[model samples]
Target: MTRRHRAGALVLSGMALVLTACGSPAATDTTDAVKAAARQSGDTVYPAQVANCGRTVRVDKAPERIVSFFPSNTELLLRLGLKNRIAGQTWTDQSPPKPAYATDYRKVKVLAPGEIGREALLAARPDFILADGEYQFDGKKLPTIAELAKLGVPVYIDSAFCPKTTGTATLTATTTDLTALGTLLDVQPAARQATAETRERLSAVDKALTGRPATRAAMVQIVDKQLYALAGGLYSDVVRRAGGRNVLDDTVPKGSNFAPLSAEALATKNPDVLIYHYTGAADRAASEKWLRTHLAATAAVRGNRLIAVPAADFSELRAVDGTVTLAKSLHPDAF
Candidate 1:
């Protein structure tokens, strides 16, 4: 069987073991007691089972020590008021925590500037781990999901980065993830509140732009002079929710998140709005200038409709904020 199939089988087998254990009379009695206590205290039930990626992550209790592998995952935890639970975090050098989370983010231990080595991760004594992508558990440079399971550590991967994920992310999917995290962490109330707030904000955006036409837009990144456009996935969803249509959605292959675009192709599409992502203001200015000089014939350049956004905003948790930002830019009068 292929590697993916093998991994799926392993996950299914592990879930079966979990179900078997929970089925035992002693385990069921304890679980019932815990649930009764939690209900009395108005807390989430114990042993929350969340389907993550292709694995069923069974959390018997809220994790006290969580190692967040990406800024997006870290931010989500912080948003849920679980800053104290984060034992360590990584990948904050290029994209620092959002302004609202800056203080709490600073207090967390920096496991590494980029990917933390397996040794450092284990040293943190993390009871739970949150990763933004499947690439983190590649098993060569880092510990795989099965390996972590063997060590009694449960890992949750963002569905947006799941291997089988395709098309674009939706607000519903985003809230589903938030709800799952909340259940696993025993913070269902907080998660529900956050989800409500997100829906309300997006609903306002939708109400405002109800009859307005969608602006044809394209999100692109310039690296060493080559141009890459966001063709699908979270960014594409952001654009769609923000009263803009991603011009490259139909141009790129299905399930492709990003692809290099030729000057000719970009000029041919001539999107109404061009969003250029960058790490810093200087980089943003440079990218805009490059696009203007290289694809001067495009409507985005000629009409001065170029918008610059931080590259970090394209992440899972931040995509909501990204949508709001893009909507304001695309339909300034609506807001």
Candidate 2:
């Protein structure tokens, strides 16, 4: 299969659907119990919708009208074949458009947290809301989870990109989160298929790299004038699984998810492979020019082995589709 087509398949095959429900207190509990029972029939259990910052949330029903605050979460919903269900979204999210929803995106609805307040959200009347963790939610001055719950709307905060973490991450929460999504969406079989297929693809890549000397790699995301380095957390885990050695395994100078590094410092490390991540309006030419201009001293620049990866997949390191997207970008040679 072509890389893009394979990527599409990879995303579809490893789906996770997060379901949320809200209503009267007693009825909500009863519905939650029934849904939980239904989910138990599958291999995995439903994950508790924990509190973020200081808000507690418990989602029990399948949300009919959903609002996604983050781009990755929106992509996740789109990949689960749930585009029709997404009622509204935030513009800051940077995921690429899925063909399935391309024509309908404009019609779905757009609301900026920076401009519109919780009242705008309430007006949308979403049964469930997916937000960009507690920090952004608080920063945007939106209603707290407790307040949303009081209004009978359950909010799920994305902690996949939690800033407090350090070093290479395991992605345990990511895996469980996807399974939880499956149960919520009533797509348990599809979710299982998606997860298993991802494991298989990763295993195949690992087998291909077996016994070969590991290539030292550095994951760099470009943000304006500076380049942000991704540490060995969930993002790092995917690189390792695809058969690469993260050069920053030992560097803990700053926080883990993203670290600031000088161009000279990168040259000193002299990695065998360099991966560049870009978001809006970036292509191979842009990536190569950036490397030649700012990272000329690096070994990858000298050898011409630098690769520009789509910035969309650089943030959260969960979901089968993302793994597939990254695998194709990092290991095109293996395929």
Candidate lDDT values, in order: 0.81, 0.61
Candidate 1 residue lDDT tens string, 1-335:
73323444555555567777787433334444444555555466656788988899887778999998777678889999998899999887547678998898889899998878889989999999988777878888788998897887989887876767745555566787888888888787788898998898889888988999999998899988899977687778888889999998876667768788888888889898899888766787899899999888888888999998877776656777888989999999998
Predict model 1's lDDT versus the native. Answer: 0.81
lDDT of 2 by residue, 42-77 (tens): 522333355442445565655678887756667667
Model 1 misplaced regions, further than 4 Å: 1-34, 40-42
* lDDT of the structure predicted as candidate 2: 0.61
Name the top TM-score candidate.
1
After superposition, which runs of candidate 2 have C-alpha atoms over 4 Å from their true positions?
1-56, 91-93, 98-107, 112-120, 163-168, 252-255, 282-287, 315-319, 325-333
Q: Candidate 1: lDDT of 275? A: 93
Alpha carbon lDDT of residue 294, candidate 1? Answer: 89
TM-score of each: 0.85, 0.73
Which ten-residue region of model 2 has the weakest summed lDDT? Answer: 15-24
- For model 2, what is the alpha-carbon lDDT of residue 123? 81
